[model samples]
Target: MRQKSVLVVGAGLSGAVIARILAIRGVHVCVVEGRNHVAGNCHTVRDQHTGVMVHAYGPHIFHTDDAEVWRFVNRYANFKQFKNQVKAQVGGGVYALPINLHTINQFFGKTFDPNAARAFIQAQTTPVIAPARNFEEQALQTIGRDLYQAFFKGYTEKQWGRAARDLPASLLKRLPLRFDYNDDYFSHRYQGIPEAGYTDMVARMLDHALIEVQLGVRFDRVDARGFDHVFYSGAVDGYFGHSYGRLAYRTLDFETRSYEGDFQGCAVMNYPSADVAYTRITEHKYFAPWESHERTICYTEFSRDCGIGDIPFYPIRLVHEKQMLAKYRDLAAREAGVSFVGRLGTYRYLDMDVTIKEAMQIARTYAKKAGVAALPAALEAAA
Candidate 1:
């Protein structure tokens, strides 16, 4: 009997993980990537002039609370311990992000303990607005008008290309403000960057005997009839040629600058003023603080609507987009011998860890259905 063959689209974390899992189970896997490189948005390359590792698309810090997901990534590359400490530049002053105790004191010129600070902020919050309607209302009701204007309003406007009031309240739910001085951006237990680089780590993940990766190959050009199963990680709308209309997405434009020494004295610095055109500036060297370099590279990110032939980054799941996404999901469910997985495949913003975990689960499901050997209990649980 002929062995089963699988075609994995978009050789990013999702596609790479799925391809590796199936390849290890004696399945012939052919991974196709539209880009010339292996890793999609997480692609990292060393700068020729500065010798610093640059995040080709944008910064991607691997952070997860799941121990199984952390262990799975460690098997591929040595992950150095790294914490994301974000700073905000608001009203011509630098402040510690997440509206922590230090920020509260700095912004208000008062030293208040956790309880006192909590009480003070509560008093400042909008009393009338209960069950906030939109992003602006949520910010005002939760963090007060001053902090909202200083930290969220303008930044969100620039990031989404719309007024804060126009966006949904659910967008601000993930943002947390603390009464204590913990300046860590993510509250995840495991946080780090791959020591070598994400691309190197992804390449290691795809290093299997039964796996063959073809770069610069579009999935539409591939003849799907040749493969037993197809796992597509590309945009769902693109698969059917946008028959139900394109989903809304926000793409980023990075203005990278080379500096002699230290530029911003931090990894990430967010500009939260309406006057500022760009959103944030990220210094690449700070991402890998363990490694030292004389020169530094930084990227100033500007967000805009994703257009034709542009790489989609953040999905704007507004009412219209959600309706289009629902249609796409319906179309995807009816797709035979094909499964949609990952950020673009599902039309949702997903972190790297969640993307990996879901891909592993999908792969394990395929393996089990194909009557492959039962994976370890821990591995199955991890997926």
Candidate 2:
């Protein structure tokens, strides 16, 4: 045995991957997941009522350009190739998202050449100061009043629970727009969903006999000294007692409905208009189209600022929050005996592949770190 023990918190994709890698390398590992399930926000289970899979929190479509990340996930679960093509409903018309040539032509009801289309957009964009201020300015600069109002203004306000003008311009740094008729939301080389769902993949990852997983258990309740080392994956703020201050996050509310047949023609439809309370609607059956079922299920996602009782999904990283995060990082740098791993610990919006790659990297790096441990003979005792 190289490393005797490690205490891991939050059994999301990151913690699970780290724990599995550590266990494979002859380290005794114990994973503590605050939730009863393992996959965290990516958790999905088959609905008992309809037998259709439900995204417990929200829809998390996997997309990536990294070949290593793609191959790593494929080892545990088979992925069906699924490209995301999103539709936005604005001004009583459905248009392709990311402002591709198809969207521009359809919106204007004109067939313009690529060069003409590009020039037209440049003319339409608003002129502002050299540097943009907020999200509204960013949108306005990219596409002036007409298009910005139609597409970004309302929906963005609802999602963040703040005015677009108040939000940071960096939020929309990469405004997706095109002069060609490509409507794909993501330009990644690989994109898909797990064939059976995320749970099946996680279950396989934690299948090692040496790895012990206890659900609905908090890491703080467990004795830290018993484990040779600890891998904390929960929110760094929560782990550190929120001594500095609580970080702000945005959570989502999902309302699901079942339909006899196809509810929406596409997998996802964005309601950019403020009149609609929900931001977007997602059809789950379309997520796994290899096998068809009689009925379909859909969920309308609504984003709002996280409250005391709400489950935090996306971190609201604005200017003030970034300043606060710097302090937290300083504290984490000195958080002895505990190695923080995962999105919450790192505090970034990481996808499945990024999370997995990071965890694997941490595992390998820490395995070498075990050599410098004060208690060199602990592994033999643990065995």
Candidate 3:
């Protein structure tokens, strides 16, 4: 009998993880990536000028509550403890992000305790609207007009290129207005950046003998019939030739600048004012605090609607996009010997941990059904 062969599209976290798992399970995996390098959006490279590890696409801080996922990553590369303490530049002043007690007290010029701060914010909140409907309404009702306008209004408009009133309230669900001094962006059990780099970690994951990684190769060029199973991690709309219409997405443009010394003095600093064209500036050196650098590299991030050739970063899952996504999902379900996985495949923004977890789960499911005659059906069902 011929050995089972699998075609894994996009040699990113999703594809690499899945390929690694399947290869370990005695399946031959061929990993193809459109980009010249692996690790997908989390690709990191050393900046020759500054000798800083630049997050090529953008800053990707690995933070997750899943112990298994954390352990899985650590198995391949060492992760340094890094806390994402984001600073926001609003009203010509720096403030701790996530709207903590220090920010509230500093903004209001009061030494209120957690309870007092909570009460004060509640009072400041819009009392007229009992239940908030949209992002704007929710912001007003939760943090009141002053805080919302100063921090969220302009930034959100620039980020999404849409009024906060037009966005769903669910979008701001994780954005917390804390009463304590904790300024850590995420409340995850684990948070760190890989010591070597994301690309190195992914390369290690694809080091198995059964896994063959072919970079700068488009998925469309591959012959799917050659493989018993195909795992696609590219854009779902692109796979179907966008017959239903392109799904809405936001892409980022980075303006990187080199500095002699410490530039921003922080990993990330948000510009929450309409006056600034860029949303935030990231100092790459700060991402790896363990390493000392005489020079620094910073990137001013600009968000815009994803164009035809632009790389899609965030999915704008509005009502119209949702409708189109449903159509694509239906089309994908009908595809034989193919399974859509990862952020682009599912049309949802996924964290690193979740992506790895899902890939591992899918690969395990495929391994379990390796001997079964109805493997394709089981794989499609799992997807």
Candidate 4:
């Protein structure tokens, strides 16, 4: 019998890491990427017009407390110390996000201490609905209508293209309110951007003698009989012929502009007043603040329902979508010689750290299998 050659569809980080690991162990691997670039949504490139390191898709910040994943990524590329600070413009004033101490003082026209701030916000929130029902109800219960309307309500509506009242309460967790002056977006210990860009990081991972990369190639499984195992990192619903119908997804459209100098004083600014058509404006130069460019590039992000030919960015796991996803998952479970991973495959929003960690776990399972007879166990363990 011929040796089993593994074929991985999608050259994203998840697929790249898996291929890199197997290739290093003397296993033959083939990577098929439909896109010309390797990194999927995390793809970054230098803008020829603005000469800035632009996040081609959108703003992607590497943030996580997982030391193992952080260390693993650093081995291939260097990461700069970048802290995310997000500001929102509401009611003709800009305030720090995540409802920090400074935001409360600015929002209500008063400066209060830590204890006073907590008490003030608590008093502001109404407990009309005993148990919160929808996102609006949860917000009103947590921080009251004033702050909720000013901060979350409009932003959520803009991003999801639905009213807060229609959304589920489970979407809003314990409203993270900081009594201190901390306004950092993420609470992760490790937060930074790859100095050489994410595409470079993926390139470094896939650069191997035993690996054959085929860009602009689609795997149909109709006339393919070479590979021993196949990995699908795309939409699970599409993989199964949309048998359970297409899972709902939210896609993003970026409106770009060239600016002479600093556009927004910061990296990200949210116009959450319901008046602005777009939700947020991201300055690409801010992502790479270390190197200054003569011109700056900014993207006005507009989120909408995923249509045909549109790249699905965020999965909207609503009640109906959840039921459809369950059916798709069952179909995937019964499939052979294939394992699914990543956001689209699993139908979950995953950061870079989680994506890499999942790939690492998949690699371990494959290594333990050792032979063809044990590959099914490896697939089960990976799933």
Q: Write the per-residue lDDT of candidate 1 for residues 96-191, one digit (tens) a residue.
A: 988899999999999999999999999998886368899998888888988998999999999999989989999899988998999988899999
Q: Pick the candidate with the highest TM-score.
A: 1
lDDT value, residue 279 of candidate 4: 91
On a 0 to 100 scale, what is the lDDT of residue 84 in model 2?
79
* TM-score, cand. 4: 0.94
The better-scoring model by lDDT among 2 and 3 is 3
- Model 2: residue 124 alpha-carbon error in angstroms: 0.7
In candidate 4, what are the lDDT values of residues 260-353, reduced to their tens digit? 9889978899988788889999998898878888888899999999997799998988889999998998888998878888988899988899
Model 2: number of backbone collisions: 0
Q: How much does candidate 1 score in TM-score?
A: 0.97
Query: What do the candidate models score in CA lDDT, each in turn?
Result: 0.91, 0.81, 0.91, 0.85
